[model samples]
Target: MLIWLFLAMNFIITEVVKGIKHLYNEEVAESLISIQDTRKEFEGQATIVVFPIVRFSKKSPEQTANDLGAYLVDNLKEVTAFNVVKGFLNLSIANDYWLDLFNNSLLQPDFGVIPSNGRKVMVEYSSPNTNKPLHLGHVRNNLLGYSVSELLKADGAEVYKVNLVNDRGIHICKSMLAWQKWGNGETPESSGLKGDHLVGKYYVIFDKEYKKEIEALKAEGQTEDEAKKNAPLIKAAQAMLLAWEAGDEAVIDLWKTMNGWVYEGFAISYKNLGVDFDKFYYESNTYLLGKDTVEEGLAKGVFFKKEDGSVWIDLTADGLDQKLVLRADGTSVYITQDLGTAQMKYDDFKMNESIYVVGNEQDYHFKVLFLILDKLGKSWAKGLYHLSYGMVDLPSGKMKSREGTVVDADDLIAEMVATAKQKTEALGKVDHFSEEERETLYYNIGMGALKYFLLKVEPKKRLLFDPAESIDFQGNTGPFIQYTHARIKSLLLKADYTPGVFIDNQVALSETELDMIILLAKYPSEISAAAKTFSPASLANYIYEVAKMFNKFYHEIPPIVKEEDEQLKRLRLSLSDVTAGILKSGMRILGIEVPERM
Candidate 1:
């Protein structure tokens, strides 16, 4: 609001100056105004750069700034004082203005949520394969996707969260084949393992045996390529895939059984992670959908058929090589299915934008997918975006799924919860809590720590995840923010202030109090910036700053309940209450929960 006020003051100043010296139009004057927050050492609320308009005033930057500042203070009641720092015109706003904004902000229920902008956004994340359990990488994907979705919704977009399960293809067949040959009728019930873990075990087994077979063939003097291509295990998996595509009942039944187990496993993990989807897309259902689109492209000269009858799109003009859409056998490739799925999603949601929350490794894949769709003359192709994020590594090294070296999502979550319990107990603060309450508190802290750690980094930057470090109660971590929130809640509870109690504006404010209010005032702007960049990291860090500032204020300022002046005590309590509310709302945007007690 101060920024907008500065803009209005600048406009009025320009209009009045026009009567004296008409050197520039209103548009040019508007462009010349650069308003920003005043630096901490400066005694002002906002500063406007005066150098950009000095030519129009025919004076030195400092002189022009002083002139403009004096004019503003004379005309505007809100402008209390002004200072000229070189080309910067810093204006201190009246305390009543800030108090009024703070009071009004408390009255609005949806304080930070923007009004709906009449746009729909579809986010696709957690595109898992049935051959494996959700791993650490998938954890990042799901968290980022879900957080971005919530972030957009906070900025007033109708968001649709969807998951496209990679439940079919050769990789899935490998798991099925391994189970058929070596499982000996083992099920999740028999092995006491989750369904996805069970399936992932067979997938690893298939890879191990396949590698052994290839080594044997190499020992017989065959080339590596020959061994890999002619391996009996791989051939069997390929045959199983063909059988699956041919609609063989036995293969279908097996596919359904194994995928059912995976689905159940995924559901448990998703629920624990606090992520959800409004719709689910399966590769089995959507794989063949793009063939029609490919055919249409062929007719429209967007694609060409080779001698083997495989359909291809020439993208060299777009700085990429030719891409395969359909094989000679009339089977759709990954991109083919993606093309159809993109169209299908648009038909379903009529969204203005579609974001795919995928890893950076698939950057080229998405580039080709979007280019093909665009060349095919689809009007909505421009809205397709690949939210390409970097991979998350552990301190040990990168995780490999086929070798079973990946950190399982469920296991990591359980470890976080256990770590939370251990740390919370060591703190010795929750001894008075009931067993159930303790359990819930541990869960909230654990999940909150995990989600915040993953989301606090920029989406495009690679990160190293250290579980031990993440659960710490200090630094830029989730538990720290949660603890700050809990501290504020405790203060408010002890003060026994009634909700919606209006504080008199006559009381003098401390520097800390005004600083906290200023930070609180920027919450809506933070949300808008986070939404624009599709980065929850912005909000994550913003909330952390708020929490940190509140903590500092709590330590430096007088105790709320011990204060003698009732009005000052109420004002401090009001600040604590509003800070807690903002922490809760900001954490919610990141899909992290802040507990009332830590």
Candidate 2:
């Protein structure tokens, strides 16, 4: 699906550049591409040339170039007049050329996509465990992963969205153990709690009880470590694990109940957030998948067996410490599963790039994982990327699940929607919308605000999630952009405007309008860069810039008013349509919905 998108984008870019050359009679000197930026070099070919429209330098150079281009329009150095200022040389084509861009940008279905040369990208994220409900941290992960995949798709790459579920392990056992001890046949239906949160509550309860057990063991004259090892909960968990491995009916039955609850909860959250997966993997089924690979490595002399019958890889030669591949009992660990998954995905998709959208704390893990994969002679290991986004911190400091400081995803989203509803009512906006429409609008605005807040910063930077402040609608936010989109919709409705109409060709481009065009033009480059870097924040920031510009343009240039300059009003309204389209497209890149009425 994504492989063709990149090729299409490349084709469109080629055509657009070709159009630019024909319109301006200039030849591009060179084009530069980066993981995060792009530049195009051009040389004026006409004897009498147009002026440079943009200058990257100060007023001195800008003024000089402005004067030079104007004086040479039909005078000296007329054909090759424009000069590069710093790196941004703006070539001023005829007024008709600007009109041409407006028409083309509006008409081209794939206006901003670069042509793809058959690259495949696989993005993995939202690897939630069944032990608890997702929290704000997972929200960040999902948004980042989903948005990056979207951006890659937009950039014309074949993108596969994948996820790994930590369905097995002791952490999951905690929830299962707690449910077995205290559930007392209480189901989500009877408890009136969301399944994941209900299980999470018990998980929390199990810890408190486990702590008391530890205290009791310590009072019996045991060391703290010894007490922990002997705690009843720990012992019970170990016993239950043995039963589970033996396929005991009681343990397996409880596991099914608790895991089912968590799965239902996950489905609800993913549906609400508009996140979907092209593939799903479970650790329970695949955790030991890499055992054969490890054995192969041993046969190939890439790994060695310790005296304890465990397999280990010595990575000090690769600037990493030695690491365990398989335990003495021959159980595969986290990295082992990942190595197998990588190989499986490569064999399945032949992907050129694979992105793991995990937290920054796992930096060391991925570093070792990739190195081992490469050492195992998988050439595609070099393409493995750790899209390590920073943790979501609270104003109070880091969120600790054991301390009960973590915010639940379902609860937070509900709160945001309720807040949006309240704001809508206070503004008397709901009176203008149907009941169902109002509810939908709330969902759109609330989720938009939340997703945008998470995606507005660079991925590597830690995000301070302030529930109160993050929901603010008045400033640089998703709702702010949604409001702009709604405002445009409102005007179009009031004026009865159609989509593809150009009421007046006289654009009369103001600073705001020109700025909007330039910003809009950056959309393709921004999408490609963000896709390359696996950062949705880049697209988020770009949309916010568009909204800011449109706000300025709206207040300074009214589209519908009595006795307004009809020609100017028409141009402004057309520009508003363009701005709205760009906003809609950009917001889509972030997996956000821009409500028509907010």
Candidate 3:
């Protein structure tokens, strides 16, 4: 498909060259070279009229073509005919003019990177809480984080991926208390549940049982409001927290058991997603570490001690509400722990920037954090960015743990893999491959589809998880892209062609083929843009476009039919090979896989 596009683009350039020659007549050769001088004349006219394609402001396909056309026309000749119409620009390039530009693009070293090199970037995401297994929200967070980090790496920046584990908090304690109250000596093995799901089940059981106990109190002549506030289950949970805070052995032991299970579950999910962390910070280990920093700030007058012995930062001057850094009891709050984590990370890496890939609900928290950091005279505070993405809402409603509608991460992945296996079997192609090979391929395609669907949208936009619609195998989905790649692989094998060997034969390209080639060539540019904006969806959309274009080209052009020289066929095959390489690499950034067959 890529080869066909390259040939088509080559043909378009050939046609454009012929047009330029006809427009210039005998003076075409001199006019093309002389155009380099903006002052030069082209046949009696002071300017040569060139028509460029129309483009939109939002960086659509038409805009890209128009920009490229303008760039080519401008460089080839001085006083080139180029003007913007509404948004479209028509630019003309002489036949001889295109010959030089095409030669340069074909031979350029590290195409596009030199012109687009930017700064280093770091994206941190997948900060899972240890109280429950990961859910749909974590899936989007991880996908976007991983993809953005990869985009930066591809664009000549040092990229670092990190994860923060919310290993402590009252929520985690609830899971532990529930486990102790209900869980006997039963293990995940005995229960026949995935480790994470088993732990999550106990957590759900805790919520249900707690609510039931409250309702029971209301039924016994107690006022509904009082019963809700003074339920025995709620009291018991509070007592457990006090015990845990007081270093009670029993409470600590229970906390360890459930937390370990949740962590183990998280490990499985991360492994399946092919996600890794350059560094891992646990909230428990860092929660108390911020106390000293707050104390220092208090002394420096960066923060003030409230009358109740709590510490507070007046953020009203910064157009935000004042934030409490510590409770009157000297207990660290969420923001306090984050302060310590930020300091620790900077001390360790001294990175120019630190990005927190968190949800948008905490926008105020991050704003205050950076302001407080700035108050502390930390120069790097300016570089701290909170990449707040929107929440993932299901078609039914927002996921509610109490209502039991939260999609468990492990369950989701398992279901996707199962669906993939069933599809592969239905296609009857699994029989031709070994069991191990077929399973691997199925897993890749299934997981890729899941990740791509989530990451293909902008991070700041709320996502609707329509399971059936999202996992569609046809039309603008991950499976569609995988199928295109698989089809290319199948074609390559059939052609028995080798890449890197230049062919001497010339072939004409259809318009569809040229469009695909142009799209493929724009990959490096798209990757660079994605990295610059910290938006993985941009690249995700670009890959989808490439896949769509390649598919169209494939349907229209026959690679193996009526093609003459082995060299020409091989050249085309090389383009497809490169396209596949880019697809596989780009998908990897989003923690997706491309199956050789799907």
Best by lDDT: 1
lDDT of 2: 0.76
lDDT score, candidate 2, position 466:
85
Best to worst by lDDT, what's the order? 1, 2, 3
Q: Which has the higher TM-score value, candidate number 1 or candidate number 2?
A: 1
Per-prediction TM-score, please?
0.96, 0.86, 0.82
Q: Please provide, for model 2 over 5-38, each residue's C-alpha lDDT reduced to its tens digit, 9 standing for 90 to 100.
A: 2221233234323433543444442142101111
**Per-residue lDDT over 1-598 for candidate 3, one digit per residue giving the tens place of the 0 to 100 score:** 1121222134334433454444333223322221111122222111222323111122543444345445545544522455433333344324333223323453243444434245545668899887777888888888777777777777777767888887776676667767777888666678886666777777788789888987898889888889877887777778887887788998788677767776777788898877878988887678777887798799899899978999998888778888899999998888888888888888877777778889999888888898899999888999889988999999999998878798877778888888888887888866879878988988887887788888888989999999887667777778888888888888787777565454342444444544444466667767767776788888888888878777776676665534686544554675577667667777776767787765
- Considering lDDT, which of the candidate structures 2 and 3 is the better prediction for this target? 2
Ranked candidates, highest TM-score first:
1, 2, 3
Displacement of the residue 15 alpha carbon in candidate 1, Å: 8.0
Better candidate by TM-score, 1 or 3: 1
> Which ten-residue region of model 2 has the weakest summed lDDT?
29-38
Q: Locate the minimum summed-lDDT window of 10 residues in model 3.
A: 33-42
Kindly list the per-residue Cα lDDT of model 1 for residues 1-598, writing each as its tens digit.
2353322235444543552243333235454565777888888877887777776777898987777777778877778899999888888878887777677775356667689998899999999999989988999999999999999999999999999998899999999999999999999999999999999999999999999999999999999999999999999999999899899999999999999999999999999999999999998899889988998999999999999999999999888999899999997788989999999999999999999999999999999999999989999999999999999888888887765667889999998899899999999999999999999999988998899999999999998987668777578988999999999888888888776867687877788888888788788888888888999998999899999999999999767799999988888888888889999999998888888887
The clash number for model 2 is: 23
